[model samples]
Target: MNIQDKLSPTAKEIPPSGIRKFFDLVVATEGVISLGVGEPDFITPWHIRESSIHSLEKGITSYTSNAGLLELREEISKYLETGFSLKYSPQNELMVTVGASEAIDIALRALVSSGDEVLVVEPAYVSYSPCVILAGGTPVSVPTFQKDDFKLMPDALESKITAKTKAIIMCFPNNPTGAIMEKEDLEKIAKIIDKHDLIVISDEVYAELTYGKRHVSIASLPGMKDRTINIGGLSKSFAMTGWRIGYVAAHPEIIGAMLKIHQYTILCAPIMGQVAALEAMKNGHNEMKKMIEQYDQRRRLIVKGFQEMGLSCHTPKGAFYAFPSIQATGYDDHVFAEELLKETKVAVVPGSVFGEGGKGFIRCSYATSYSKISEALERIEKFVTPRLNGTCDKVI
Candidate 1:
């Protein structure tokens, strides 16, 4: 009769995300300059927002097809072709979901059975492990080195594979670390996947945000189109997080299975979001380019700031985050982040929140204004440098 007793065992077994806990602490404090959350500082483009309003004015408030509106899918198809040289048939290969988050969950659920093993590269986004576990699969964490720029190595992946391995979850232009896999690296991975007949869930939500080079999809590689599920969304690229629209493209059979699960579990993604996303695909490229350029400037500033502060940060090739090592401070990520917040009132997520290979590091999101980033760096320098001189007992 107890409410707690009635909870599912999986719910009880999973621990709260370390990242969310830090976010809660950051939110409670005033005057805190947070480089913690990984979201764009820009508002959704006016044209994109206006498109949603236009749809509402037309009284288009109804559930879209479970697969999504054909118009939106067509736009997505064209966008993919134009941007990535990827070809996906709008009719059978795509299924719109609430966000890339839902696409990840559905793909894991649809493809994995009990005892299946899911290969995850760390330090990854925190969502992947729990989703795999919830789908009755064991998550096998593969540690990637900062020395390697956190790129997923084919050898590391091959070492983790076993007969029970069902899929490899690829998050490039990655979160937390911001490492991106180049085309040659992806070709190597594709060879391994083909050799093992593995399915790949390519999470490319940050594809449009890369700085040094264009984002390459493993799905676009030779022999990979059929085995790869391309997961992308408007949230990161178009700054439409609140809209909750994302999707996946794959072979019809794979998409069909995902569609069935999505229909029963989610019914449809937000209708307005689909309409907004359609607008973005049709006319939002210029807006995305401007934002990406701004982010690139911010990225360079943050990386430079960290290096000047005596912390070694891997110059992230993509995404909006900088993962800087805190080892020189003689503190773990959790301790370093807490002390930094308490002393400098600058909040950042501890890298350990992203799992193994993330210890002694912290993730600083550059999705804020340049002035804020500068001010935060000043505070960080004042708080951390003196500690090294033994002038302060701690960062505080």
Candidate 2:
């Protein structure tokens, strides 16, 4: 039987996640100081874990309502209101999902239909393009350059829109580049979005991890609330990646459409995760702030290290990633990352896997400890020194 031929063509066409490919390699190897995966190195905080333990001890393991525990939704809604000035009704406009991964997937699936095109901002999270394709929608790449700090330009965005363009999927405090879009930046892009009359899938998973400025949701801007799908989660902020707790705030109508897909496929997010998320939402702010401070220190450390080593790096304003151009090393990103891993046992993800704008760069995450990041910096500098041969121009 030709079983492969019988499978959905779309499923076959989808490539495996690039982030996990290097991660798998790191796992099979030994002594690799990894800066590949974007996950925080911190264990889930003690209090949040206690909350889950308390739930399981009480025998509360059954699935909650498909939209998730109502109390959790209420906390998420309150968090959004207090943090971003965006109000949502826990009963109708909010939903809990397995993680921001599931939230991104369902948001695309809910809004995109066959023959529709979703504009994906380039150098985005690895899943954005694939999720759009899996939803049976065409993905149109809207490239942003490093020269602009990888911010989505209004002209570049509008140029990609057409009658078939159904929505735009964008992440600020972007995954690979670690760039952020402040209120002024968002206001400009929002003007283009408003003019085009399109829906937006704004992934603000790193919203709380900014260095100096606060995150401003494009959805919070006037006239954008009704047309935006706001994605957030505890995965990064609370160091709860394994717990798989995430949420969405959108128009009630959009939430209803997404609920159909979620209830059928996921049924409900794990009840224990919902419980833990509630605890985090209510009391995890101080710990989150402490983690942010550590990330800021490491961010400065890593970016400065790259610049000193003669590789040009933008000082990331948000998130814990440092994306440095490898052109000075006379190698493309893929070759540099692979060769770095093979020679020095240091693992970093190549930028090309992220999209076209990332071709000559590499993404090094600073979500680990200060000493570990410092050691990785030493290894990276040693690896690059001979390759540049003293002719490299210092960008610092």
Candidate 3:
């Protein structure tokens, strides 16, 4: 009578999230400065919080339609059109989801079947390959490198295509790496997708957090509107992660298929979250700008700190992370992260958890306060300096 004997193989096979494990370690350790989690440190904007409060005050805590509150969906449609020049019909082509995470899950489930292959660009968010496996698809890693700023090249993608390749799961303003694809880069990838007749799941959760240039949705590219599933939410952009609201925009056929799954699994996103999201769309722009400005400053500080410490750090143009190579320390990613945590009481995610290509790197989040980031940098510098100088066999 073993419970494990009856579990689904996929469910049993799935590994625990590496991010959560490090997060837990940080929580358990005393006096640790964590640059691990990718969540924004800012609270939800006042107006957005007020909207959710007002909704609760009015006794409006109930489920909306399975597709979500029509008002919210309409707002999402308008947000996309105004921001990215992408158009989606609120009625048939868009559905509110629990989070961008859920949208990704349902999109993969809807598009992939047994023996189907989903091209997952690495180093990607931890969820991508697991969700693909859960959906009965084989995840084929198309690795991108640090030298190239981790941008997914058309040649790399083209080489992986086979008749079984159904879709590509792409995340720009990528987690861990913080790499973003320019319009020209995406256009090239889009051309390859068009030629191969493959679909794309564009996870743009960090779209609004880009620094220098604006984010360009692949769905907005020529001939790409119908072939891409656009996923986004208020989590990264508006610091509303706890609100748990996200949405998906795709062609009617795909939306309709995803809706079938959503209806049964999650009838609707929380009504209060929808209200908060609606407020975020209408009034949170100014607040978001302020937060972005702060994140940009922190981004520069962290990347520069790592570079000055002998780590080859990439300047992230989007997202609040810096993936710095720890190769000079002569330690693999996991060892470096663990030793740094133990010795310096600083928590950062090991890049190896992201993908194989991430082995020599470490992902440091700059989403915390500026003062904390500066302090953490000082601490990290102290820890890695001796190792780089070859004066200490162990970094403590």
Candidate 1's residue-wise lDDT over 322-381, tens digit each? 999988877767888998899889999999889888998999999999899999999998
RMSD of each: 1.4, 2.5, 1.3
Model 1 lDDT-worst window of ten: 387-396
TM-score between candidate 2 and the true structure: 0.97
Residue-pair clashes, model 3: 0
For candidate 1, give the lDDT of residue 392: 63
lDDT of 2: 0.92
lDDT of 3 by residue, 251-368 (tens): 9999999999999999999899999999998889999999999999999999999999899998899989999999899887888899889989999999988888788899999999
Clashes of 2: 0
lDDT by candidate, in order shown: 0.92, 0.92, 0.93
Candidate 2 lDDT tens digits, 296-330: 99999999999999999998988889999998777
lDDT of 3 at 238: 96
TM-score of each: 0.98, 0.97, 0.98
Candidate 3 Cα lDDT to native: 0.93
Candidate structures ordered by TM-score, highest first? 3, 1, 2
